[model samples]
Target: MPDLKDLNSIYLIVAFVVPGLIATFVRAQFINGRIDKMTDTVLGYLVITLIYYGFSIPVISWILTFEQGLLKTALWWGLTIVGPACFGLLLGVAAQHGWLRWMAKKLGLRVVHGTPSSWDWQFANCYAARFVMVTLTDGSSIAGIFGTASFASTDPTERDIYIQEVLDVDANGIWNYRSEPSGILILAKEIRAVEFMKEL
Candidate 1:
């Protein structure tokens, strides 16, 4: 026969552990920018916790009335195992629906995709007074100039330029390259603007 104290302790442990496990699983499945995903993940976890508590109270109360011995313990174990799994699955599904992508756009970040061209390299060496390497896919932008061709690679259809420094360009089309992280070399022909960053 489980005592009242034992039942209470078991319930408390289940209540805490279930939500935590759910939150952990949610975090693991979704990979994106940290700040954006974290906010949504926390909000989801809170809602799941509330729902679990609300439903469990009535169910546990009813179970306690019928089976007075180890019934509460069994219920606690069930909730601990099941509650988090369900919540984690829900969060994982929500994450796949462009949640992080939308958040990145909201924050004035966008992704672009393109291959490099030979003309781009020529432009970099000659006409490209400076260079700004913008990673449209990752929403990361680096600025530098055509210091030198650190490395180069290409396929039958495209070329890539690895710039020693990233260049910065203004709306006026002025090139201003500065010393920054080493970036990839891409051909100019392959360069294509995919997305834009709107003011958030």
Candidate 2:
């Protein structure tokens, strides 16, 4: 059995948990609902924390070998935590930007453009500056040109978008914005579907 009263052992527990906590938070922010369950999140955090610390240990060890005072030691410890976090964040960004797709193409692999992996990228890339009809869950809809759309990387299900030149659909189902010609805000819970119109 291990000695529970040891101070170093407590620090070891903290060291083990900190990386996972930071990794999980970063990944949750970046990937959003990709991790649905608590168990999945915990498992993913453990795996990523392991991978990060595996690479970080040697570098941290080498840096700590340098002579340092109290302040410098604290700075090194800060670096140890921040370095892996920055790396994890960069990885998340690269993943979101379709880096994998780009790599596959470079390797002579064929993949479809406008893949659904990154919904925010897809919306901003494909739908921005284009006309669309946002159908609400209650059977009403507003058509307009997509001006600025905001995506929730923190909560993937939260669909919030902004529209310019807001149009009202007549009983004949035609859209006209001449009367209003203002902006409209749409929320996710109210939206049922989005119909793409002509590109501008």
TM-score of each: 0.33, 0.63
RMSD of candidates 1 onward, in order: 15.8, 5.1
Tens digits of lDDT, candidate 1, 1-200: 22437988666544654475564565434422122244455555556677666766876676667655586767666666666666556555455444555777899987441113433323323422343454444454544544444433324344454556555668896656455554555553555431222211
Clashing pairs in 2: none
Candidate 2 lDDT (Cα, whole model)? 0.65
Model 1 / residue 29 / CA error / Å: 1.6
The count of backbone overlaps in candidate 2 is 0
Give the runs in model 2 whose Cα sits over 4 Å from its true position: 1-10, 33-40, 101-129, 138-140, 149-165, 168-179, 187-189, 197-200
Q: Which ten residues in a row have the lowest lDDT in candidate 2?
A: 147-156
By summed lDDT, which 10 consecutive residues of candidate 1 come out lowest? 191-200
List candidate 1 segments past 4 Å from native: 1-14, 30-48, 55-58, 70-72, 98-200
Cα lDDT tens digits, model 2, 1-200, are 23559988767644664576565555444444244465446555567667777878787777678777886777566654776578667666665576867999899997775323555545635635777888899998788777554332334557676676677778897876676468777787887878878877
Question: Model 1, residue 193: what's the lDDT?
Answer: 37
